[model samples]
Target: MKISATILAAATLGSLFAAPALAQETLNFGIISTESSQNLKQEWVPFLAEMEKQTGFKIKAFFAPDYAGIIEGMRFNKVQVAWFGNKSAMEAVDRAEGEIFVQSVDAEGNPGYWSHLLVHKDSTLNSVQDVLKNAAELTFSNGDPNSTSGFLVPGYYVFAQNGVDDPKKIFKRVINANHETNAMAVANKQVDVSTNNSENLRLVQARQPEKFANIKVIWTSPLIPADPIVWRKDMPKDAKDKIKTFFLTYGVAAPGKSQDQVKKEVETLAGLQWAPFKPSSNDQLLPIRQLELFKNRNKIAGDANMSETDKKAKLAEIDAKLADLTKRMAALK
Candidate 1:
């Protein structure tokens, strides 16, 4: 009986020691809603499986109906890591204790991508001018509020610069949807114009050629930085190192990899519209921060509802931020 009791006590102690290891083996990876969850999963599953194989963690994909859901998930520690555009990454960094560890490279070797304003091929809106001039008669489909290419880039370069404070107020109707839905809506004539991105439009072209055939680009914004991979700042250092190593090496031609293995890995990245990953930090968000400040400045400049005294004070504040950002950006150069 004494020997049995000692064995039982030893086993219990071992199980207690094992519990945390088991817990650490699972990681929830959040994916923002760029398209339908089904489509996103189709592109991500193989890559995530590879990550699981490499890192020895049971990787699960977490999807939300909107960008904010992923942000909130990370805030609550339910999501350990995520892929986020510059604007959304800023939100995550500022609000969710997230840190950018890596950025995705474009498959075609482009340094960055562009935001697009799309109209149906059959529509008369051939340019940004035509759309703005006819805003009173058209329904505009914008993107998720948190989207960088879909929202912030266009919001600044398109409407804000034109002194239009709100597209919803000027257009006949305005609605928000994801990149895929926006492209589809324009193709189907559900809306006259919508915002999309070059990367996503390429996917539409490949995945739904018929829809692609019906779409036309009316305007494209300046180049925007590639997307970033963010992990919660509080994640274990060992886990973070493993994840960083996985991203920085995946899809690259390694010495031991067979030609077929390299080919398959490259193809998987292509499906996600990315090349191998590059190391990045929160500094990647500087241009996005500038864009936001500019947009806010425009809003303040156009706000007739505010007293002149208040408006001037707000504008001064934004200008101070812009100047500081400009100096920081210049220093990087």
Candidate 2:
């Protein structure tokens, strides 16, 4: 009888210990490597602290050396939520079980940001034309393959449109790095030219004014959509609701927030280079998808090694996809 009683007590204690573990879930939030993890953590820690306080989930920040790391993290269910640029987010949604729930708004109220081709202020390169014309003489610092502004935007608008499908064939040397590193590389003359974005340039201006001053924008791509916040579609409904509510209300003037509270939240958001979270859906990826297809079409058309028959068939497939995307975009409008 004593043995049976001890077993019952042990089971009860085990259940008690496990109940809190089940109730208090830990959420890992992944941030793509736009800059160094240290810089990102400085801008993100306070905001994540607030998320923890408001959502009642233990929030942890996850950073990767490259954008693909975060995408793979979500694919394996290691990251519950993440902030992803358009191109990476498209990859995530298509490859991982990811869904876009909210998007960032620029602190300056701009609807979107521009991608830039940068050179040292003292460099002779004055435009994209000059860079392309002199490509064989200059070493180029490119953005990560997964970066939209760093690679995709410029890949299409600059190289593909000009009939140069691969940068490696033209440039003397091609090196890939994050925006911050690329900007600094140009400023320090480590590379002749590199890709960056308006948002990160603003950060460089604030963090390293001297470097920012030495960098000149030789060319700018058309506006790219703001970044998106994605979470695994399998995230619990209650957790999703809490996360969405926390983001949408964080910097906004809510009824219960004191003036000081609102001001503090605003400043926190400004540090992150955003205003407030706006509700978003997968439809935000439509423009990015169209851009990808357009870039592929151009590449196919420019490929000299491909047979005419194969090129025609590949281009036709990309064109059909582009047309379908166009129709979907029109329907949205």
Question: Each prediction's TM-score against the native?
Answer: 0.92, 0.92
Residue lDDT tens for model 1, 1-333? 000011112223234224346434667788999999889989999999998887877778888899998898887766778999899999999999899999999888887899999999999999988999999999999999999999999999999999887899899999999999999999999999999999999999999999999999989899999999999887766778778988987887777768888788899999999998999999899999999999999898888899999999999999999999999989888
Q: Residue 252: error of model 2 in Å?
A: 1.0
CA lDDT of each candidate?
0.88, 0.87
Backbone atom clashes (below 3 Å) for every candidate? 0, 0
**What is residue 249's positional error in candidate 1, in angstroms?**
0.5
Model 2, position 32: C-alpha lDDT score: 88
- How large is the C-alpha RMSD of every model relative to the true structure? 7.3, 7.4
Residue pairs whose backbone atoms clash in candidate 2: none
